[model samples]
Target chain A: MSPDEVHYPGAVPPARTRFVRSLGLRLHVCEWGDPDGEPVLLTHGFYDHARSFDLLAPLLAERYRVVAMDARGHGDSDRPDAYAWFPGLIDVVNMLRDLGRPAHVVGHSWGGGQATDAATLHPGSVRKLVNMDGFGPPEEGFHVPGRDRDERPAPGQLAGWLDWRVANHSRETFRPCATLEELAERRRQQNPRLSSEWLRYFAAHGSYHTPEGWVWKVDPMAARNIGPFRPEWIAPGWARLRAPMLALVGSEPDTWGPLPEPMLARRLSHVPKVERGVIPGAGHFMHIEQPEAVARIVLDWLEAG
Target chain B: MTRLRDGRAELALHELGSGAGPTLLCLHALYGAGSDFRDLAAAWPGRVLALDFPGHGHSPRSFGGSYTPENLVANADVALAHASEAQLVGAGLGAYVALLLAGARPDRIGGALLLPGRGLAGGGAEPKRAEPEGMSHARFDVLLQGITADADPDPMLENCDRDIRPPDYARAHADSARLLLLAEDDAERPPWWHAVREADCAEVAPADPEAALARLAAS
Candidate 1:
C-alpha cells in the first residue's frame, strides 16, 4: 500500500524489511516465527504479494519458520511482465538452491502448482509439499498452446491504470505493511491480495491523478490477445517432483468441477506421493474463505511428519 | 378485472433441446445477456437456458427496482423457471446474481461458474475501489465511458443508481473474489515469498465465461 493509505477493519502500521539474493530477480520476503524453528515457507498465488498471508503466517510461525514470498508480476518482485511460465519456476528453484536446505513448501492455486513443480524443477530444494488448491493437473497446454503469445492486458488500459498508480502511490506501494499485526488485518480483508492492490496500483500506475481522483495507469488502448495454451506436452517437465504433496481444493470448483480426470492423472503420474482433499464450505477462494480449515489442514500435515 | 396487475409483466420465453444431459443456465456480465455464455454451452452437457438480463437485450424494462442485485436475481429467478434444473453459469454482473441466487436458493442452482465478477463490495454509491484521491471521479467517468462507449449506459446506469458508474457501461467491481483470490494464493506451504504483500488494489477480472458458466451444464 502507498504510505498514508488508511484502510478498513482498522489501520495497520508497516514493517521493517530484509531480502535475499539469487536467481535473476530479487526475492522480497517477510518472516515470522522463530528463525531457529523449522523453516516453513509460504508462497502466494498469482498477482498476490506475500504480506496478504500475514494473518495465517504467524499462526503457523509460532511453531515453525514462516517465510512468505510474492510471485513475479505481483507484489514487490521484479515485474518481468514478460509472457513466460515454468521459466519463473526455475528462478524460484535457483533461489531455493541458495537457501542451501530443502524447504518444506506450500502453495495455493498457482503457487501450489509452482511449489509442486519447484520440487521437481530443482529436486534438491524441496522436501515436503502442501500443494493446496494448486495441485490440480496442469492445464492441457499448461503454458498455453501457442509459445509466441501476446495476451498481455491492454497496454493502453494497463498504462492508464499505471498512470493512476504512479500518481497516487509514492514509494510505499513497495513498502511492506507497517507491522505484522496490521499486515495480518489487511490480509484478512484483502484475500487473493492483488485485486485490491492492483485496482489502486492500476489507478495509481494506470492513470494520472489530477485534482479529483485517479485514472487508468495504462493507455487503455494497450492491445491484448487470448490463447489456447497446451500443458500436456510439458507434462514430462513436472515428472521429477520429489515433494510429498497434498492437493487442497475448494468444496465447490468453478466449472472444472471435481478434479478433472486428466488433471488428477497428471498430478499423480509423476509425483506418486500426492494427497488430495478439500476444505469444507470453501469455494475457489478456500484459504481466504476458510483459512482456519486450511491452516488446520496444513498444521496437521506438518505434525504428521 | 382480468388481474392485469398480478402478472409480473409479459415475458417472452424459449427452451431449446430435449435431450437428456446436464442443464446449464448462463447469465451475462454487466451489459451482457445470457446468450454471451452460449459458446460454453456447446462443450457442456445437457440443455442451456440463456436469457437477457432485465434491462439489456430483449429483456423487459427495469420495473420498480432496476439494476441492483435484487433485481438481477429476480430476473434470473423468472428465467430459471423455464427449466427443471440447471447448473448456473454467470459472468460479470450475471455472476454476482448467480452467487446471490446460489446462496439464496442453492437447490435451484446445481453449481455456479461465477466468472471474474463483482462481489458484495463492488461499484456503487461509494467507490469500493480506492483511487488516487483527486482523479477518481474523472477516472471513473472515463471508465464509464470505456464501458458504455462500447455498449449502452443510459439504461445500464439508469437502472442502477451509482455515481461512480455512468449507468452506461460495466465496471469490474467485487470485494470477496479479490480477497478470496489473495487468500487462495497464500495457502502455499513451508512458505515465504519475496514479492509485495498486502497491496491495496481494487480492480478484479471478469469471471471465466465458459470455464465457470459452461461447466455448470456440462457436469
Candidate 2:
C-alpha cells in the first residue's frame, strides 16, 4: 500500500513539480509539455488533486503548456487551519499572477466555481475559461444557508450539521482502506464510470499509505465547505465574466454533477460568450472517463479563438 | 448563567440582571463574543442573557465548523431555549441571525433590536473575506474593536456573502416589534431600508439598547 510500491501502468507523471506561496501556504504545482508554450492551468474538483489532471493535461499540453495545482488542503499543498468556499478564488487569482501573464484556465467541479469567480473578479488574468460541470446543485436543490425553506427546515438541518461537526472535527481522519486496491475500489463506488486502472492511478496519487492502511490526503474539514452560497449568486459573476468560456457536462448521469439541461441552459445564459457541449457516454468525471473525447472538445474550444 | 451542554456542543450564556420581564437575549456582532456585551448586560434592567454564539467565546466551533447563518441561527436557537420568552438584541452578524429567528420563532422572540450589521440590506457583489493571516490588527479593530483578539475571518466572510439579507424580512417585521437601527454614518444603506413601506426601523447614532429594550418592555 505504500506509495513507493504502488504503481499504475500507463499513468504519466508531470514534467516538473514545484510549489508556490499562496495565503501563507505552499501550494504544489505540476507542469507538463513545453514550459514556453502558452499556459493552460488545470484546477481539480473537490477532494481531488493536480494529479487528477494527468489524462487531460497531457492532451492539452500537446498544444499548450499545461500547469495543474493541488488546491490548498488537497494533494501535497499545505493544509490550513480551516477551509472556506471562496479562498479557492483567491488562490486561482494568485496562480494567474504567478503565471506573469494571462492563461487559459480549466477547472472541474468546485475548481470550476473557483475558476469562474477568479475570471470574473480578475478578468485580465484569464484569456479563456473552461468549466467542467461545476455548476453547483440544481436550483431546486439549492439551500441558502440561513434561509430555510419549507422542505428543509433550519432546525433539523442545523442539528444534523452540528452533529456532523461533533463527530468529524478538523483532526478527524478518513477511515483507511486495507489495501491500495481496496482504496481504488472505494473510489470506484463513487466514480463508477472511471476505468479500474484509472481509479487505481487516482487512488495512488490522491491518498497516502500508512501503517494502518491507505487514507485520502484531502482534509476531513473540507466536507460541507459550502457556506451561504446560492445558485443565483453565480449568475451575476458569469454576467460579468470577460473571458470566452466553454461549458461542458457529461451526457450520462453521474454522482457528481451536470444539473438538469434547462437549468444548465439558464445558468449558461448569463455568460456573454459561451460555447456549451456534452461529452458522449461520459459521466461527472467526463475527462477521466473519456479523455480523448473530452480533450478533443477542450482543445478545439481553446484554439477556436 | 452557566454553559449549557446540548449533548453536541456547550452553549455559553453570559447572564446578568434578574427579575421580571422577558430576558434581554443579547447576541454579539460577527467579530464579537457574548462577553462583548458585559457593559450592556450590566446596565440593562431585568434579566439579560447574552449568548456566545457557537465558535465564539467559550463555545466550541460550530457543527461542521461552519459559521454560516444557518449554523449561527441554529446555535442561537439553542440559547433561546434558556429563557421562557425573550427579546433579541443583535449587532451585525448577530442582528442578521436575530431577524431570521424573529420570523422563524415568533412566539419565542418578543421583539428584536437589530443594530447596524452586514448584508442586512442585501444585493451587492459577493463580499470577499479578508484572510486571517493577511488582516492587520488595526483592520480587525476597525471591524469589531478587537473584541476578540483572535477573531477568525473565515466565519465573518462566510456570513457576509451576497445572500446575507434576511429572506423573510417582511415576515420578521410582520409586527411593529422589530427595529432595524443603522449607524448614522453608514454610507451603504441596505435596499430594504428604503423599500420598507411601514416598518418600525430607525437610522440614528447607534440607538441605545436599554431604551429600545425599555420601550419594548413598556409595551
Candidate 3:
C-alpha cells in the first residue's frame, strides 16, 4: 500500500512526517502543533513506532511543538543492519541538534532507556528528560559477574553455545497475524487497559501487510543483544546525565516484571537530579493506557520549573 | 515471516522486497543478524530473505550450545523452506555455512556468494584470543573495528562471545554456481577453494560491498 493511503480512524489531528539522515540510516520523525512553539521530542520503545504517541502528542501540542520519531528499525525508518543503544543515543542527539535548541525529551520503554542515555551523554541537548519504565532488569538479572571476578565459558562448551544460538536465532522470526484485528487482540492481551480503537490504530501503523499476513514493522534484528546488559554498562550513563530527569513507572509490573524497591532505588541513585512517580492501574505501557494522566504529570513538571 | 524450528532452537527469518526475480538468501557472519543485508536487499531487484542464525539475533539460544557445522546446516535447511528459489550470500561464518548448505542441498540453492572466511577446510591460525570476561565497551569497539573498519561498528558483533571449533572444508563440495570473494590472505580462504570442482573465485577488497554484489550478479 502507498504511504499516503494508510490512515488511522481514531488518531489525533494528523502530523506531518519527515525523515532525518543520521549515522547512515533514515529516521522517520512525525511533527505536531505549531512550528513556532517550544519543541518537545518523543521516542517510542522497542517494536513500537512514532505513531504510538498519537494519543499523547496531541495533548502536549497545545504548548509545545511535539516531534515523535521512529527509531531505526521501527516504523517508517530505515532498518539498520544491527541495533545498538549508542546509535540510538546518537540519533536523539542529532535530532536535538536539528531542532536548534535543547528540548524536553520523553522516552517510553526502550526509548526511555535511550532518552536517559542521551540526557546523560549529551546534557546540553536535553532541557528535561522523562523516562517511562525504561530501566530494564536489574544488574543481577544480566547474569554477568560483578567486579569481584570474571567468568568464561568452559573449554568444551563453545560448540554447544554455537548450536544453542543457531536454534535460538531461528525462533526470533516475525509471527504473522491473519488480520489487523487479530494483531490488536494480541496487543490487547498484553495491555488490557488499552481501548480497542487505540489498539487497532496502533496495529495499523505498527505493522506491515505481507503476502503471508500482517507482521510487525519492527526489524527482527532489533530483538537481538547489541551490547552488554550489565549494570556497569548502564549506570555510568545515568550518572552522567545533567538534565532534570523524571522516571514514571506503572503501578503494575509488565514484561520485565516489578522492579524491587531496592533495585529501583539502586538504579535511580546514580542520577544527580531526578524525581519519581507511579501511574495507578497502569502497566509498563502507562503512556498509552493513561495518556491524560501522563501528559498532566509531564506538563505540570515542565511548567513548575 | 516463517519460523524454522529444530528441537529447541528457532531461527528468525526476514523476507524483504518483492518480484518474480530470483530470491537471495542472505546469511550474516558470526555475531551478525539477518538485517545486515538491508542495504543489499534494497539494491537487489529480487526478493531477499535473511536468516538470523540461532543465538545470534532474535533467535533462541540453542538448548545445548550446539555450534557445529551439522547443526548450522540443519538451521539453513529450515530457513530455505521459506523460499521458492534463492541464491546464497554469506559472510564470515555465514560463508562457511553456505558452503556446507550448497553441498548438502544442491537442488535448493542457486548461485552462492561466500565472503571472507577460512572455509570449511578449517584450520587458519587460531583466531586472536580475546577474553569476553575482561571486555569493556572500548575494547569491544576495537574488536568491532577489526571486523569492519567503519566509523560506526555493527553492534551485533557483541554476540561473538561463544566460540565453536572450525569445520574441515576439505571434504565439502559445491555443485551449483559459486563465487568465493577471497579475503586478503589464505587465512580467510577455505582450504577447499582450490579443490572445489566447480566455482568462480576472486580476491576483492573486503570493504567493497558493491564489488561483492557485482560478483554475485555476474556469477
Candidate 4:
C-alpha cells in the first residue's frame, strides 16, 4: 500500500495491485486508487517503469483508475528471454481490455507507439491518446527525411557509438544520490553531452549503492535493441495507427533528439484527425525529466475534449 | 546467469565469475530490485551473484503474501543454489538478510559483512502511533544540505520510501535474536562476531576494531 511497494523504474513510487496485466504471462501491472473510477492506461518509456508516472498518477488516480503496466521484459514483468513486436502490441491491447472497462491510452516511447497501435487496431478500446515523444515510421524508404542536411550519421548507426557511449557515459550515467535535492543539484552538473532536460530523466530513473555510487537500472541491452529494428517492420505498423496523437519532442537535440519536427509531421500526417505538433522542453523520456510538464500536457489534452 | 526457479515464486538469482575466488551472493534492500547491489558486488574483486528477493526485483510478486523475514530467507536459499559456498556481503538494509543467511546457516558463508545495519529483529515494529510526521521543509532543506560523501545520507536515508524501511529493519532484528546469527554493532564490536562466536565457537577476538576482528576471524 505504501509508495515503496511497486519499485518500477525511475522516481515514481512503486506500483501496487493484484493483477496489472495477464497476457498468459503473469503480467505485473500497477493500478492506483479505486476500481470503479474512470480508467486510464499509462504506458511508460522503454527501460522506465510504471512509477515514472508517479507525480501525475497519484493526482489522476485520485479520480481515475490510473493503471501503469511494466511492459514485458522491462520492469517486474517476466523477461521470458524472448521478444516479438506485434504480439507484444496485442498483449497490451488485451491487457487493457482485461481492465474490465475502457480506458484512455497514454503511452511513452514503445508504450506510446503501442498505445497508438492499440487505438488504431482497436479504435473503440481507447478514449484519449497522449503520445509523448513517440512519432515513428520514418516517412518511407528507411530515410529519416532531411537528416542528411545535418550530416549526422544514419538514424540507426549505433554500433560505433555504443562503446564510445558506455565508456564515457558510464561515469556520467545518471545516479542521483538518495538525496533528492542533492540529486537535483547533481542535475545542474549533468554532463554537457546530455541535454539538461534529459539529465532529469537520469535523476528520476537512477538507483544507489551504499558504498560505490548511483546505478542506472536500465539493462545495457535496452538502447542497443533498437539498432536491429528494420525499417520495413517499423513503417507497416504506422499504417495501422490513426488515434488522435500528441507529438512531444524534448528541447535538447544532442540528447532528447526526436524525429525532426518536419519528419514527425511527415510521418504523422496520415492520422487524418491529428491534434499535432510538439510540446516544449521535453526529451525522449519526458515524464521523469519533467513530470509536471508532461503531466500538464496530458491533462490539458484530456480536458480539451 | 539469473534464473527464476520454476514453481518457486520470486525466487531468482544471477551468478557471475567463478574459479578460486569465493562467490558472493547479494540481496538488495526492500523496495529495491536485486540489481541494486551491483555496485556493492563491484567493490569486491572476487566472483559474485546478486539475487532479486521474491517480489522486489526480478522475482514474482508476493500477491497478498508478505515479504517477511522467513520468506526472504527462503527466497535467499532458493536463489543461492548456485553458490553452495561463498563469502556473503550485504549493504545498508540488505545486510539484515545476509545476517540471517550467515547466522541461520553458517556453513554456507565463508565470511559476512553488514554495513550501516541495525539489528534485523529489534525493538519490535515501531508501534503504529509512534511514527514521526512529515519533515518540516526547513528541516528537510537542512537535511538535504547535510548529505556528504563519507557520511552519505542518500542510500541510508533513501534506503527506500520510509514505510518499507522499518519492516525491513524488523526483519534484520529477527536475525539478531538468533545468537549464532548475530554480530557486533558498536564501533567497538568485532567485525565477524557470528563467525568467531557462533561458527568456530571460540573466544577469538575482542570487539575493539578491525585488526582485532581480522585476527579474531583468523583464529
DockQ of predicted candidate 2? 0.11
Best TM-score among the predictions, by candidate number? 2
Candidate with the larger DockQ of 1 and 2: 2
Span of 10 residues, lowest total lDDT, candidate 4 chain B: B156-165
Q: Write the per-residue lDDT of candidate 3 for residues A1-305, one digit (tens) a residue.
A: 43334455435744688888665567889999998899999989887899889888998997899999898878888764334455577678768867889899999988888888777656677899998888866665533222232242221122233344455543333778988888889877656667787777788878878877888888665654311134534554466667888889989866543467788778789788989989888888887788889999999998886
> Model 3: how far is A170 from its true place, Å?
11
Q: List each candidate's DockQ score.
A: 0.01, 0.11, 0.03, 0.01
lDDT per residue (tens digit) for residues A8-118 in model 4: 333445346555433334556777777787788888776566656766677666567788877765555654322334335655666666776667888877788777766
Give the CA lDDT, 0 to 100, for residue A124 in model 3.
74
TM-scores for all candidates: the values are 0.42, 0.72, 0.56, 0.44
Residues B180-210, model 3: lDDT tens digits? 4443444634444544433443344355666
Better of 1 and 3 by TM-score: 3
Candidate ranking (TM-score, best to worst): 2, 3, 4, 1
Q: By descending lDDT, how would the candidates be arranged?
A: 2, 3, 4, 1
Interface RMSD of candidate 1, in Å, is 24.1
Cα RMSD over interface residues, candidate 2: 8.8
Model 3's alpha-carbon lDDT is 0.66
lDDT string for model 2 (B41-112, tens) is: 765667888888766677765432234555566567767776867877787677767766664566566667
lDDT of 1 at A69: 69
Displacement of residue B5 (Cα, Å) in model 1 is 67
Off by over 4 Å in 1: A1-16, A81-83, A136-229, A234-237, A255-258, B1-219
